[model samples]
Target: MTGDLILYTNPMSRGRIVRWMLEEAGASYETRVLDYGTTMKAPDYLKINPMGKVPAIVHKGVVVTETAAICAYLADVYAEAGLAPAIGDPLRGAYFRWLFYAAGPYEASFGDRAMGIEVPADKRAMVGYGCFADVMNTVEAAVSQGPYILGETFSAADVYLGSQIGFGLQFGMTEARPAFTAYWQRLAARPAYVRATALDDALMPKTA
Candidate 1:
């Protein structure tokens, strides 16, 4: 709970989501940017994340990989930031609900869609997300009643899920329903989100 926090990320990767969560958590951390296929696959980096993926974090000697896990870890450790509902808090159920929902169904469905991997109706039961329409509709409903995922308290769920929604919108993956558009707009206006985006954008690779 009291050690240096190190983030291994790339500006263009999902690491941006972890960066946003770090800013929201108000944690002091160092960042090491790993370029794809080089530093990312280097032996040293692989030790941190055997999968050799960006957006890993080392905190108090604990290594966390995967964007949602990293965000949740930061939120729990930095409880003072109030980025998660406390254990036993009624909202805690809903917090985990949407957080893992995004990490699992939303992520799976969106990735499949982007890759044009359709799940036939007969195979829908085997796939966790069921179908693209169901997944998107669920996402729409999740944000429709919200200024935040938990209705009011903005938690790390928003940081992870909002980043997914934001990315999906930017890349033309998600439908621009009014609810999603308005919800993303609200999250984009957060001070932490602004800072995180500016920092990452500054690190983007230059174009010729």
Candidate 2:
């Protein structure tokens, strides 16, 4: 594999999720550490991601931003590596459903709880997650049936959603339910997860 995958990221950020995904995809990538207020927001990087996000990626002259989008993009581009479910596969629906659910409602609920913000009684219906309890319950159900999120096959859904689950529990934004603990334990055994953790740890000091 060519080392043409360019990852623009900062240490101690959501970029770690993408790093784990790259390892899982077995994509040879080069990381470009971006200082928060400097290189990350500068012209060149801004051109790549107008929002000035650290976890963007550039490959084969194409740019992808957003952690979920990036993970899904890599899985599709490196399809031969089998990190994603094929387009017509029935499991693809399940993969996308959980992936987007994590990116949207799960994240929203996590943020809401972490900040101690409660949705207004009248506005609850307008909220995508509906209720934080729903988010946790759904996640618990999904992880309970898993060797991975997709069941038996560890897809990109596991990487993105699993990372969020890890962060939420680690930061005390969410509860440490039995299913979450079990799923995380299984995820910890993957070589990709280990390599990703080590690489990010090594780069942390340099970027910090």
Q: TM-scores, in order shown?
A: 0.97, 0.94
Pairs in clash, predicted candidate 2: none
Candidate 2 stretches with Cα past 4 Å from truth are: 1-3, 206-208
The lDDT of each candidate is 0.92, 0.88
Residue 61 lDDT, candidate 1, scale 0-100? 84
Query: lDDT per residue, candidate 2, 24-116, as tens digits?
Result: 888998889898888888998899999987799989788899999999999998798788899899899999999999999998887888788
Determine the backbone clash count of candidate 1: 0
Provide the lDDT at 112 for model 2. 88
Task: For candidate 2, give the lDDT.
Answer: 0.88
Q: For residues 1-208, could you state the per-residue lDDT of candidate 1 as single tens digits? A: 3248899999999999999999999999998999999999999999999998999999878999999888888999999999999988999999999999999999999889988999999999999999999998888888987698899899999999999999989989888999898999999999999999999999999999
